[model samples]
Target: MRLNKTQYVALHLLMIFTFPSYPPYLIVAYYKPELVACSIPSAFQGQAQIKWSKAMITVNVLTIIPYALTALIIRSRKTSSFSRRLFRSLLLVMIFDVGSWLAAVSFIKLL
Candidate 1:
């Protein structure tokens, strides 16, 4: 499938926001849950909490790079059909980012 200029731009922007928009919530929720007026579940307190927070940060940061790359590739392209490799990369970015966003939001709600 080919994306027109508008779709390319919009998707790129959305991917770019994927990291900036959501990960900070996870980070904040990790460090100062009280500031967000939400507490981690009692079950997750102590060492478990710390471990979970570290893992969350690691995964979120890892996903950010690819999404940023996908966004950059999309932004630089001037054609109707981007390379198949880029399309695959973008698809993976969307899948991972969307999944991570959903999970983060749900976890934050628990906070």
Candidate 2:
């Protein structure tokens, strides 16, 4: 699959947005439940909490939108080479997402 420049950028952006801090968040939630839970209600917990949550939601949503769009683009039986490459790239992103999540879970469990 030969991804065009736009598709390559899109896929890289999706991967960046999806997985960067996800594992750390998962680990924190697992190991520091009280702190994570309290931060949600503690308005004065400072700007970091607010910023992190906002970024997390925005990036996750952005990642999902592209993947869904790619799926639809592929399912429509579009025959463009670029679309095919985009579809394959999106599939790899999906796989990487799952693998990252699993690795996070395993690491948390091992601790």
Candidate 3:
């Protein structure tokens, strides 16, 4: 399905809340842990926070493999009713991807 301008806008806004995968933040968290505590809620002030933050981001980075592959398949294929169905399924996958990683992050915070 070809997305019209409005549909694209709506999809974008909807995706915005899905805990964005920002590489720069992960970089700062890895190289300069103190700096990220203010920006990253789970990253508090401590040496352990640095390790946990890096591990959480690492898991998040790994999860992107699946998300990217699904996205590439969707984009490489022609838009059609089938693609729309795939897009819908992709949204579900996206939700699960982000949710699972965040859950893992939360779990790590407890450790």
**What are the per-residue Cα lDDT tens digits for candidate 3 across 36-110?**
423454444455456556765776677678777777777788668787687778778777877876786687657
Off-target runs (Cα >4 Å) in candidate 2 are 1-47, 80-86, 94-111
- In order, candidate lDDTs are 0.62, 0.61, 0.64
Model 2 is weakest, by summed lDDT over 10 consecutive residues, at 36-45
Structural RMSD, model 1 = 12.0
Instruction: Give candidates' CA RMSD values in order.
Output: 12.0, 10.5, 11.0
Clashes of 3: 0
What's the lDDT for residue 85 in model 1? 64
Clashes of each: 0, 0, 0
Model 3 TM-score? 0.35
Stretches > 4 Å off in candidate 1: 1-41, 79-111
Error of 3 at 15 (Å): 29
Model 3 error, position 39 (Å): 16
Model 1 C-alpha lDDT versus the unseen true structure:
0.62
**Distance from true location, Cα of 28 in model 2, Å:** 21
For model 3, give the RMSD to the true fold: 11.0
lDDT of 1 by residue, 17-76 (tens): 884555445445545344333544333444545565666567767766876786676768
* Candidate with best lDDT: 3
